[model samples]
Target chain A: MAETPIRFGILGCAHIAQTVSRAICLSPNSTLYAVGSRSFEKAKKFSEANGFPPSAKIYGSYEALLDDPDVDVVYVPLPTSLHLRWVVLAAEKKKHVLLEKPVALNVAELDEMIKACEVNGVQFMDGTMWMHHPRTTKMEEIIYDPERFGNIKTVHSIFSYGGGDDFLRNNIRVKPDLDGLGALGDAGWYCIRAILWAAEYELPKTVTALREPVLNEAGVILACGSSLQWEDGKTATFHCSFLANLAMDITVLGTTGTLHVHDFVIPHEENTASFLAAAKTGYWELVTGMSAIPSQHVITTDLPQEVYMVTEFSRLVKSIKDGGSKPEGKWPSISRKTQLVVDAVKASIENGFEPVQVRV
Target chain B: MAETPIRFGILGCAHIAQTVSRAICLSPNSTLYAVGSRSFEKAKKFSEANGFPPSAKIYGSYEALLDDPDVDVVYVPLPTSLHLRWVVLAAEKKKHVLLEKPVALNVAELDEMIKACEVNGVQFMDGTMWMHHPRTTKMEEIIYDPERFGNIKTVHSIFSYGGGDDFLRNNIRVKPDLDGLGALGDAGWYCIRAILWAAEYELPKTVTALREPVLNEAGVILACGSSLQWEDGKTATFHCSFLANLAMDITVLGTTGTLHVHDFVIPHEENTASFLAAAKTGYWELVTGMSAIPSQHVITTDLPQEVYMVTEFSRLVKSIKDGGSKPEGKWPSISRKTQLVVDAVKASIENGFEPVQVRV
Candidate 1:
């Protein structure tokens, strides 16, 4: 028997919601049934332009969307400062949530979200699309094989992008109160998540951080470094910068050898296109070889092959409908850990880049 | 007129003295004029075996050697624990001093040494041989060119060697109170010094360090990581380990590209007899190309390359004799900075690897 598609209602007409909506439309067992935005005109336009079915609905406000019985799940794509409020509301409405990256701004907010989900008996998962990528699985396989990679000694990860002057204005990225965290929260979160996930989500024994502040007439950290360690003696160092130009790379050093994965966050458009073409043609070798080349030339051409976030969301909906326990041991925990790390970064910045012990 | 060679004195008959003594013999404008050891028999044996000129004197003790007016400069290669005391004594005696690597156990001791040198009106330089190597100068030139290498973003350095269990027994390296600083201060000094020198000896604005203690009969650090920042917003990081097998390499990442120099601390040995014959017969290109390939198939050999420390010491002697200030920008200040960094590592270890501000 064919499985019924899970219906999704996006809580905000955020720019990220477009990515999620596209993913839902393309997913084998998911549908973008509705959308809600503070502005009624924006919601209606989003629904119309995205080709929502006649049965699909548009709501002027988030609460009205949550009240809709047809919506089985909610995709929360709100500002970092606003995540906790909508996430709890969505969970209270008994809708499974795929909250956007950085589950919440801090551990306290995350704890509240988790509690609300538990009390309402709803599944809560973070939208960490990279975890679902086949390449990440392959990385785990290679790193765990003692004969292949050996014990990891050090991990150096970097994620940066040139956010020119225009990038700082009219975006949540540069808003000190709304975003709270800057480059470290936006891009650096991915690198930190990848490391902790690869290290089996082990809580660091100690953490020391440094920050570079690019304030908006008001002082706040706009960039930073968060260095961490495991009790068994492994070091994780991450560099997060906003003033610097675009660069996203991760390098892990082990006792036997090293492994590097370039463009770990947002892969090149060409790589994705080629990957999809090869996937359609059953040419796995060509896809793998294309991925192996580290040059930007190949990556820039290949990355647009698939919509990573939508694909992961589709899987989450299927898992929930099948009554499986929330894609056990995956994105939820990873995203929570990522939020904790960001919280630590903020604490360190507040204390003048001092070492802050992460509380799991 | 040709400059007069600086007459040098040996303060101890240690293995390091043998290397220095050989370098002095090979230098064009330097000579070993006096030998000193706690044992008269050992001093006489060393003088006779090394063919010290008949007019050269031997001293039964360090004080007697300092009393000899002919001994214009003293090379002190005592154990790590004794470096401070003897350096101070040599400065008080008004003898130009070249102290061995790891100028002192910590910043406090280094400050004392610096103060002593200033008050006594004598020249003092740390014996960090790599800083004087022409290859190192070439590396600095390449890394600092903004058009060529651009701004450096990351520095990864490693130096490790394996030693037998018996080697740890009775060695100062294994004694925390004697060596005071373990692998980090003993061998990792070069790795830190290399980064600072390559970065034009910029003082880091912030530092985060992690250390691992190796347990034998007593606990000693075996590995460490340091993240540093320059005032101009450039950041650098380094790791050092001694528990691993023999390996020494340094890699720098810049905005434009990456550069790596392998086997940086030591060059591969060359067979002098075969090389001399090949050169005389005009087989230079073929022989040199074959030798350039790094592999186990090549035979171990030695080259007639210039001795790094001896050449630098000769230049320092000339600078002093010419009545000019010591080389304005040299390795001593860099060495002091590195010592301060290592001391922070020690403090971090004591405080459970918490972030400590470097005071240098």
Candidate 2:
């Protein structure tokens, strides 16, 4: 018997939603069934432009879309401020949630949203597309290999982009009441996630923000960085900015090996991604040169990373819908851990760059 | 008329001397004229094993080598504890000094060495070979190009090696009375120099050591890191360790571009080096991919970087010897700046990781 495809209802038409809509349509187990905006005209316009099939529903209000029993899941790409309201409402209406990152304004709000999903028996997953990339899994295997890489030592990550004058002045990412967290939530989130990923998801004991963070007039972070320390002597640092050139870097140093990836956030090519790894790197007899040059490991996939994200989410949602299985806990657990570190970094910055203890 | 080569006298035969001796022999303008050691047997053995010419003089004592009037330049590879005494003595003896890095135990000692060279009209140059690599010059041009790289934002560097148990127990770098500063001085020197080079040699305003540095029983740093902030908000962070795998990385982020190099300290290959440069990197229409992928810039050279260092140092020495030119102040000035940042990091660590103000 063939399994039924999960039907997705998208809430609002954020810029990111366009990409997610495409991913949903592309995924084998997911179909873009509906889209809802504040008005019927906007929803129809979005659905027409985004290649939604004629059978896809267009709703004037989000409530109407959530009320559709055919919509098994809702991909919420709303701004951070509105996540709590829409995500909880969608969960209460029995729709699984795939929420955008900077998952909430803070952990407290994220906790409430998680609770609502839990109470409604709905699956929750954040949209960190890179997590689904095959290259990430390959990097994980290499870094955690007991012989090749040994125990982790340090990690450094940077995720930044030149947003230019218009973005700095006008984007929702810069508006205090909308995205609010600005570069820290938008870009630094990826860096923090990379560091945590390198550390195998162990929350750091403390996080200390670096000095001289660039903040806009509305007190939103434009650029910032922080150093994290684990109890076992592992250390990590990350920087994120809206002012620097576009960069996505992750450098992980272990006892016996190193891993470097320049485009961890977004692959330069759609079908291929790569990371450089070196094991037991040493110098020549006279220390004139290195004995081992890092070799590149390329991973290829037919589908884009976003489609993978959608397919995985739909799998979890389908298992719960048809197989009588409980929602997968791993997705929300990782999301919570990432948010904890983000909150600690924010606290460190707010406390005049003092070290903030990270409580699990 | 052809120019006469600058005559080079070797100091006590440290392990590094073998490489520099080869470099001296390879440089067209530098000749290995004499060898010196505490014992004549050691000097003779080093010279013979290192392929010195039969006519090269072997001295039983360092003083005898310093007394040789034909020794135009003295290459000092002795331990840090012996640098102040031997470097000053060589300078006073009118031999141009090509000293190894971590230039002195402290700036006070370095100041005395510099003063001696100034008084004796001898050239002073530190043996940081990578500075002479043509790739370094090319990188400098790119980073300083305002249109391509724009204003510098942040720099991160790492130089570390897994020194194993034997090295941790017995290496001079781990000994309190010998190298004293341990990994901080040995590996951290290159990281600091890279940051300064990226910043065009402007010393940072403040340096704060990161927490939980791994130290030996003698309280010498085995692994450590620090963040430096310049007056203009240009920030840099560096980590150096004897506890991690060999890694030499430099990542510089500017408003418009980025530069990345993995093997900045020692090239993976002797004759060629490369760096990745990305200018105006942006995302695709839907932010699924990069619009401009970073391109690798491979640089090749006929002579090894060490040979270039020797050639450059000898060229300056020859100008002083033949053209009656005053010693170039650039080399000593940059070495001093690097030492200043090193001192500040040490102070910050000693003061329980408090921020230490850097003085010019």
Candidate 3:
């Protein structure tokens, strides 16, 4: 017997929507059932340009797409400022929500969306695609093994891309009404998540923003960095910028080992990724060289990470719709934790770079 | 006929002295002429174990070794506390000085040593061996290329080694009266140098030590980190610890290029080293992957970095002794700058983690 694929309806034709639309088509347990935009012409064009099935529906308004009874899930790729409204409405319509990152303008708004999803009994997961990659899983296996990695003492992450002068002046990300957080919300989201993920999702005791964050005239952060410290002496630092060249890095140092990955947010290749790990590393005789070098581990996947994310989200949606199971709490919990740290960092920046306690 | 090699005298027989002794023997322009310790038997044993030539002299006391008119240079491997006394004495005796890192207890002490060397017309070079590596020069060339690397934005460096329980309890680095700066002086020195090297030796405007520094009972810093901010908005962060695995890394992010070197302090292979550089990197279509991966550049050398250090120092010494040229000021200037930053970080930590202005 074959299980029916979950039907997906995408809200807004944002640039990222095109990628998620393709992911829905590629995921084995999901189908791109519909797409919605402000105008019928735009929706129709998106549907035709992407490989949407001929039977897929196109709606002129997001409301019409959410009203469709056949849509079991809605992937929201709207700007961050619109997330609270669209995500809550989709949950009210009993549609599983796969929201893009920088989940909301702040944690308070995200809490409303999460509450709506819980009350409606629909799964909710953010669109952090790299979390589903097989390479992330492989690295996790080594880091989690005490004998292999020991206790993680510190971490450093960087995610930055050189957005041209035009982007600095005109990109939606730099606009206050759009993605407002700018570099901190876009590129920095990945770095923050990387640090928290390296810490096994443990929230830090305090967050302190570093000095000299570059800001646009509209007061959106163009570049910034922060340090996180835990009560048990664990610490981490991260940098994110829209002014530097494309660089995605994560370095985790443990009591007896270290892990390094240069392309943590997006792999350089679609189907393959690699990470370096060293356990019990030491120096050679006379301290002239390393006793053993870090070994590189390559992970291969049949599908891109976005598709894996879609497949996983759909699998959870199927259990709720067909098997009468409850929504998984892990995804939403992780999202809220990341947002909490994000909020703390912003508060520290606003508070004159003082250390801000991370509240629950 | 080949010009006469610079005759070298070593003070103390610390473990590092063995490595530097080997380097002196290997360098073409340096010769292991004499060694000294508190006891003549220990000096004789060290000379025999370190492959000194048959004509090598052994002295019961450091003062005796420094008094030898034939010894053109003295390599001081004594503890930080003894550096001021021994280095000043060596300089006054007309011997060029190759002082081990953490050159002095503080900038003031370092200034005294430098002044002594300057007044006596003797070369002064700190034994930061990696600075002499060919790989270091290759990395510098790339980072300094404005067309390729653009403006430097941020840097992160880490140098850590897990010293085990016994080392944590008994090592001289953890003893306040000996290497009082502990990991900051030993491992952190390299990280600071790396950050400065990335910035082309521009001093930061201020420094703020991160919270939760691990300190020994004697108040020696075992693990710590700091964030440095430049007047022009450039920033750098570094971490050094005796509690983590052996990890030496330097990541430099620029406006148009990125540089990463995992084994910046000590190469994995003595004969070869490598670093990754990416210029004009961007995302692929749909933001699925990178447009181009970073290129790996491998630099090979015929001599070990420590040997190169000895050769370079000896070259300067020979130039002063034989060519009638004054000692090069570049080496002392760099060493002083590095010490100044080290002093600032320590001051920041002592001052309740507040930002401390870096006074030149």
Candidate 4:
């Protein structure tokens, strides 16, 4: 008996496409059958350099690639502004989609994509690969289990970096129309996604934001804060900046203790410690041993990006083949909630940081 | 040879006055010579109970006590509404003053008090006692020393608690006219003071704030954030909350490591840990074998409150006796900068969280 592999097509030869291409090639249950770019020459060059089968089709237009009946699932790694168009088109072709982060420019586009997938009887999953990591799973279990981490009271997270001039010159991340929220749409979504995933995809009730717009640039928010409230009466906050030096840290405070994770988005090989303080006397005793590590975890992989993307794509393929939902699939809920947070942040920036309640 | 004792008088028997009274009685070079309350019976009772000498006077009116030539200093712990009037009157009477926190209702009042003290050639100090503690000196030294703490990047601090019903029911902290900014004027001042003091009183260029009015029952701000810029081209942020459960934590981040100071405001026997990461490995290591000392230094004596108050009052007396500026004195600078931060927070709140540029 031989195992059958799901056929995958790559749309848009963007840098992110390399991630999906490698994942599809490496997964035993998936195959990269075809690829499409705005230029046929570029598509052919990428396929040949990446060791694609000679039978793998190359198309100059995305629609031409979508016309292939053999392409089972389409991986859309286009710019943020083009996600809705390609996702809906892929669904119309009776194909499932693995859309990149900032799934769409706003909730309306996401809603349309969701409806398209439902009407076509196809699956739609946002490409939030961090959610698939083993460490993320461990963190979620610890944070949600009352006996392990206790009831969460507050969450503080930051993701920031200084995008050098060469990187910002011609990148879609700096474009107002394509990227919409700029750094927020580019990298902040991961931080927002991390919070939502940890909170079990609970939509927050209110979001307050403050943005320092990049000078001489319109629709580019350099820094922002999104304060979120869940229906279960839990609150969370996400802070992000693009004009500052790099930083990625997430801290979750519960009634009994706090869990601090560093570099949450990119699982770096680092050690983290949790500090617990229950009573006044206990607090003093704990402070004395604060520098001692009770536990430490290490990741030795230099390919976290490929590892996360492959795990999520493999799960998506298995779900389609079995005619069942993906394992712990919270993509739709997470996507919708992330869109709410993004919209609230924009509204807050426009209103001078007066908190905007998220209706969703 | 005997040390000359400074004569002191208190105008009210407020809650804070109790702390000052105890300090006066314990200082070796200070004497509580008189006390004045609106009710004669209350003044007489307090004087007798506190063991004032037979020569000590009890007055039914504050005006009579101020007229006493024997009194060299006065402590004013009245309601926020009466701070300006009494501080000015005390200064006019040629008495040095130790005015309680929230120096005045607004910056204008603070300015008036500063001017009155200057014109009368009398010393006036805002009783921001946290700066007097040894821990403050240690924190400043650690944060500013690049070799020890590296480049300061971020700061987050919180102060909150639950108060007595009566304290919230009829106190000026609940009234807009007297308490002004409410919780912000009362408990929130400590948080603002800590951040400004840690930043060495470098005013921020722009501040953005968000106030949740529903959370403040007694004219208090439930939560607020102020984005600040230092003269050294660094950005800092301060957050405060009164409605949440008790929490006082301050975390300072630098390039090489992070200093996490638990229980920042009233750090009673709490401890802090430093986590460092080298540039090459980018691996964070918890520096071990560190002793857990009290988060704050205890200036203990037979009477702790008295010892704390006298520590500052005596400094002022010695400065006057020397007829020159005290090199060790930080009261003037700390008080002025604290008032500046308080004023900025108030202006940000009033203008609907508009960025208020701090002047000097």
Interface RMSD of each: 19.9, 0.8, 0.8, 9.8
TM-score of chain A of 3: 0.99
What does candidate 4's lDDT look like per residue over A262-349, in tens digits?
A: 5566544322222223311122231212222223444344344444566566566667657666333356767888887888778877
Over A25-61, each residue of candidate 3 has an lDDT whose tens digit, in order, gives 9999999999999999999999999899999999999
Give each model a TM-score: 0.66, 0.99, 0.99, 0.70
Give lDDT tens digits, candidate 2, residues A17-36.
Answer: 98898898899999989999
Error of 2 at A128 (Å): 0.6
CA lDDT, candidate 2, residue B134: 96
Ranking of models by DockQ: 3, 2, 4, 1
Question: If both were scored by lDDT, which would come out higher, candidate 1 or candidate 2?
Answer: 2
lDDT of 2 at A21: 89
As a TM-score, model 1 comes out at 0.66
lDDT of 4: 0.65
Query: Poorest 10 consecutive residues of model 2 chain B by lDDT?
Result: B284-293
Candidate 2's displacement at residue B30, Å, is 0.5
Q: How accurate locally, in lDDT, is each candidate? A: 0.65, 0.93, 0.93, 0.65
Better of 3 and 4 by lDDT: 3
For model 2, residues B317-350, the per-residue Cα lDDT tens digits are 9888878999999999999999999999999999
